[model samples]
Target: MGSQKFAVLLCADDSDYVKKIYGGYFGVFVRMLEEEGETWDMFRVSNGQFPEDEKVGEYDGFVITGSCNDAHGNDLWICKLLNLLKKLNGMKKKVLGICFGHQILGRALGGKIGRASSGWDIGITNINLQPSKIFSSLKMPASLSIIECHRDEVWELPPKAEVMARSNKTGIEMFRYGDHFMGIQGHPEYTKDILFNLIDRLLHRDLIEESFAEEAKSKLEANEPDKEARKKLCIGFLKGRL
Candidate 1:
């Protein structure tokens, strides 16, 4: 192949912090996953901008990003995005969903998504990986610490979907629907600074208690997410190297 092409269906708006620090959420994702000769384009699905039907097949794979909006909500844009996801699935196009993306993917594929009974799960968490041929080419430990910030999760998996990873705070932390579609509930694209900034935003918005914010920050100081490994896993899937 000459070069791989990819698109990011961004479902979140970039905060001023992210725009200044990482060039925006789109930039955050590209920094983590972009490879030489690969092309990355973004569609702000959060703003109702999406690839038209004629444009969907131009890329090798698609990535769905986290959003502050509830994935379980039936907003007009959300429904449109779900339809696009259904189309992509029918085509067997490779799709990677993270955070809100993960939850929405579950709903779109005949699963269930709801408020996490554990409430918010922030900071770093270690997820136990399951053995699968899809992961054979990449080196991974039994458990990998990853960045997490979500209040909703996949409550049930779609038919034929297999659980790939889980953490104490959430069940179905990661799942796969056939070889072409995967959903990860953590933020593999987030940097510590991004999480720090996010905590500040949540605090300002009164979405989290100060004590909880402090606790999440403290956890961040203790461990780092296995970002490189996540990068490899995502790239491998998109490029057929998995």
Candidate 2:
């Protein structure tokens, strides 16, 4: 943990259970993406916590996590995060955006983002990878399964953005703005237990119908995400080894 410091711009609050078991969303992400000798710092950006301007350059990469809020909204913190993303883009710093992070990166890069007409997409999903040299060295499979839970999506990509993958439910399951910026609409950092807990919470709050929750759980039972492959991709991208 002494080399290659990275930052996580967390966009969601921690559930009590998550805090107790996994430390928090920050801890969950660090477990997924961190490597030996790499330091990871988390800023709870959803609560207006962000690294100071001068501190931005101190990290080698940044990760933006999923959020309950819509990426299309104009909340003050979201606005400020967008500004920071723009600055990061200008600096060519490696940045990985996941879920809401995926949509917000699209918006910040001058794309359209809003509620998906296809409604919510939850559970395991198979995304078809397009032929892209960005991941060529990684030998990624033609298709990969991942945990997905989102009601919003990137409607249009920013200028010069390359769509890397798509699923039956999401047109832009993955996209890249440059060598340094990537956006993924699925939760590769999550395990089935986390999604199960999340589904239960959604059902309890009536965010998702009982039937939908049951179906999502069934799907989770039937399939598993390609975690090792995803970890390789994420870590490679962050470390500039790809």
Candidate 3:
């Protein structure tokens, strides 16, 4: 392919499996974008290492992927990433944070994030989008079958943030910062099989119970996409400032 028309940085702060699976998700996103005549490139930020300051502005937007690490921890890389996010937000650059990325965005934007009370580990849950310019082309009750593996949720929105979507399991499932930055707690990038494999691996490692795994699997199987809803959300994001 020719040089990318837009660049997207995928910040990965977890295991190889996260990178592998999320890469697949990015492929889905890229495919959707390409179908609409867009070109993009994806770069990784692993183990805290990332491009220097001089190269930060070369990209059109950046996406921070979910991680196994807790956002409240004192990891050096996490701190650095948070700082970088602040800088990017200050510049009004487009940034989309997913899962752990969502937690970090909340923390960076002066919001509080912590473990959920229900302790819900939603695997493939449906999201209800609120009426906004972001979902104008999408239908009401837009059910997005997304992978939700996060324990922490955004408890409070920052001064300049707006809550976009929510679910019964998680109160603040989606939020937008100022106008350009957005964070989603669920995984819209994961395919059904990929999501199942992830839950399976987690079960194998004893990270979750077998019962939970089975429930998640069933949810994955039952997930139905509102394609028009997703298309509208993506197109709105791409057309807006990053």
- What order do candidates take by lDDT, descending? 2, 1, 3
Summarize candidate 2's per-residue lDDT along 25-130 as a digit string, tens digits: 9999999888788889999999999999999999999999999899999999999999999999999999999999999999999999999999999999999999
List lDDT for all candidates, in order.
Answer: 0.91, 0.93, 0.70
Better of 2 and 3 by TM-score: 2
**Candidate 3 wrongly placed segments (more than 4 Å):** 1-8, 11-29, 32-41, 137-143
Candidate 1 lDDT tens digits, 15-95: 998998889999998998898899999999989999989989888899999999999999989999999999999999999
* Candidate 2 wrong stretches, greater than 4 Å: none
> Candidate 3 on 1-242: residue-level lDDT in tens?
43324554555433456447555545655654444455566555545566678777766667677766777776888778888888988888777787877888899998998888878575667777776665654444555656788778888877778888888888888888777788888866655666677787778888888998898788767666454555456556755622
Clashing pairs in 3: 93-242, 94-242
- Give the TM-score (vs. native) of candidate 1: 0.98
Scored by Cα lDDT, where does model 2 land? 0.93
Estimate the overall C-alpha local distance difference test score of candidate 1: 0.91
